[model samples]
Target: MHTLAQLRAGQLAGIQRLQLSCGLTEFPPEIFDLADTLEILDLSDNALSTLPDDLPRLTRLRVIFCSANRFTVLPAVLGACPGLTMVGFKSNQIREVPAASLPPQLRWLILTDNRVEELPAAIGACTQLQKLMLAGNRLRALPPQLASCTRLELLRIAANQLEELPDWLLGMPRLSWLAYAGNPFSAADEQAADAATSIAGIPWERLQIGQKLGEGASGVIHQAVLQQTGGQQDVAIKLFKGAVTSDGLPRCEMTAFVNSGDHPNLIPVLGEVLGHPDGVHGCVMPLIDPGFGNLAGPPSLESCTRDTYPADKRFSVDELFGIACGIVSAARHLHQRGIMHGDLYGHNILHCGRGRSLLGDFGAASLFAPDGPHAAALQRLEVRAFGLLLEELMERCDLPAATQASLTALQAQCVSADVGARPSLEEAERLINSLRA
Candidate 1:
């Protein structure tokens, strides 16, 4: 065992790993001398502003954790570490990403909760990258070169300033998972109101709140009937609770749902209103005829698991394939329009009967610019989520042999740890269509 003072000496020749967590602010310069044999370093929760210049000497280093620091810029020598693969720099004061500063072997880059407004175009050059997390930033756009990263798998770019998404996002052959909520452009009008404010527009006799649909992080959803309307339309209304104490604005999750708008596979928004004084944010959406519960709900997951083994008692393989295809098609449509469904899961997808499936709950969606750093990150995250969903479906026991084989192969390709190995929405659609035929 190494003595406490000897480990602090920074001259320990055989030291391969070092962890300094508490009671330290700055790293001594002499620490760089051990770079030759060091493979891992943990210096999180410090007040570090910069790294030593001679860090590149650690040719064998592979992982570095430097989260919760005061770094405005990355160390210049990080890119020089030839064997480096993973780097964590979350909760920092970073403003920009310099392309030339990243190492070629980098595979995982986590930069969440930073002040970064832009990314280097050279990021796409790192073809080996897999998981890239850029949540809680100020980025307004993404770079087109991102499509070149054929190996990327998981990406999370939630909470940015994006306004629209690039068209090529849907064309990425390997992407599957993503989440990009809390963007200004994607904020819906309904999400801007509160409970009292939403009901102010329509008279009480005209609206009748029905069964409780579900509850979200900040509000509750209910099935409603508009008696005053000549057509007697059935609608879904979400009532915002008293969570917005800071600025009186609706929560980010509520905004994502209202902004999604109308689609055959989506719950169409009829109107939005805000009740006064109480400040209730509510949205009116066309209700599904039979009111199919979400797949992620307890009932659905339990049913699927219980019916897995007995092929005769399980849901038909054709029905499962049809549902998957509908999901992919809806995702493609949303991506083509520059929208990212940040929170995609079985629970968010609702069956509309007759081989029709609707992608509901846009409470986590965002619109990003076509060629901005934010969009690139959002697309990558979506690819990762898609892979996970596919994996879940394949594990179901009741699926037919042929359908299971095809789906398993597709899921394997989409969920590859390498982000670039996942299939694009278009490719997934094609594969689903072929299976249907």
Candidate 2:
């Protein structure tokens, strides 16, 4: 939130990051003063529509975010930047993405909530690309050239106009997390209606909201008390903030949560939220145990697609096995019901010190037909994610020689470069159970 006055006075020199959002309509020439040091620039929430042709003057820039702005086209000058690799232009008026606009060394790109109908095949030139966010767009198809990006790991194409997912996407060697709900091919609404019939709906009047528990990009979780005929019960209520989130629609998330079904390692949804005065969507679930905390933190800028763990975090062989078994079982349950927990990172998991784990956060989950064409491939894609999780946990665990050898073998199988060769969740669970035995 640096001010133009401070920047003009050279008060922001020698800084690696610069953010200015005081309704900027023009590129400030004073920014060149910090070109030697600025590596990240955030010009979000402004009135800007374009970038200067000399944006390459910032030779050190690596990341630039211009979300919530007025840009209708992704700046072509971005490709000329020598070191820029990360770009975010979310919530803009962007309708066109020039092939020349993509940075040569791009590793991450976000074009969410825009009017983009197609992507340049040039995106395939970015072989180092690992993550992409294109939700809330008008894309009707994905470039087949994207299959050449072997390093890609996470993808969000929710709320787009795709008639169907590309076959190449399911067979990608490195893809793990994926969300494709709210598209023309999505059956989310129908699945949600079926799931809703099996669950009770709790009226808003019966809920007594309390202190806020936490918040995420999609919704707020709060501690609340629900009045029922039997008595009053403590619960956690999640009220969605809006129709669209970075992942997809709130109702889609709500559908995933309610439909996740019963599992020891899953957060149980008690009921659907009924009758919010503002017409906001939400759901109710059992309050999580106070002793539980996140297993790990979300990825830092440097880590990109992996979760970060506490510096001193260490797990015993038993604890590691417990977490692995629980996650595999939860995943098996999800895949069995044709659900894909698109965001299955350690950060989305809650763990008690005793090894009990609970997987939450349905904001990125998607529902698919179990017997559908891509169902098998989709399950295996998630298995690669599980493999990565196992590898991370193994790094922190104190394992016996024999146990380490076994887990490492299983991890390798889970993350095999050949997607079709990866074990299904059921098989992964079996292997995990064998390890515990």
Q: What is the TM-score of each candidate against the true structure?
A: 0.54, 0.96
Off by over 4 Å in 2: 188-198
Predicted structure 1: clash tally = 54
lDDT of 1 by residue, 4-84 (tens): 366666447678877666645667655576766778887888788887766777778888879888889866578888888
- The local distance difference test score of each candidate is 0.65, 0.90
Q: Model 2 — which ten-residue stretch has the worst lDDT?
A: 188-197
Q: What is candidate 2's CA lDDT for residue 319? A: 81
Backbone clash pairs in model 2 (N, Cα, C under 3 Å; residues 3+ apart or in different chains), count: 0
Task: Give all candidate RMSDs, comma-separated.
Answer: 10.7, 1.6
TM for candidate 1 is: 0.54
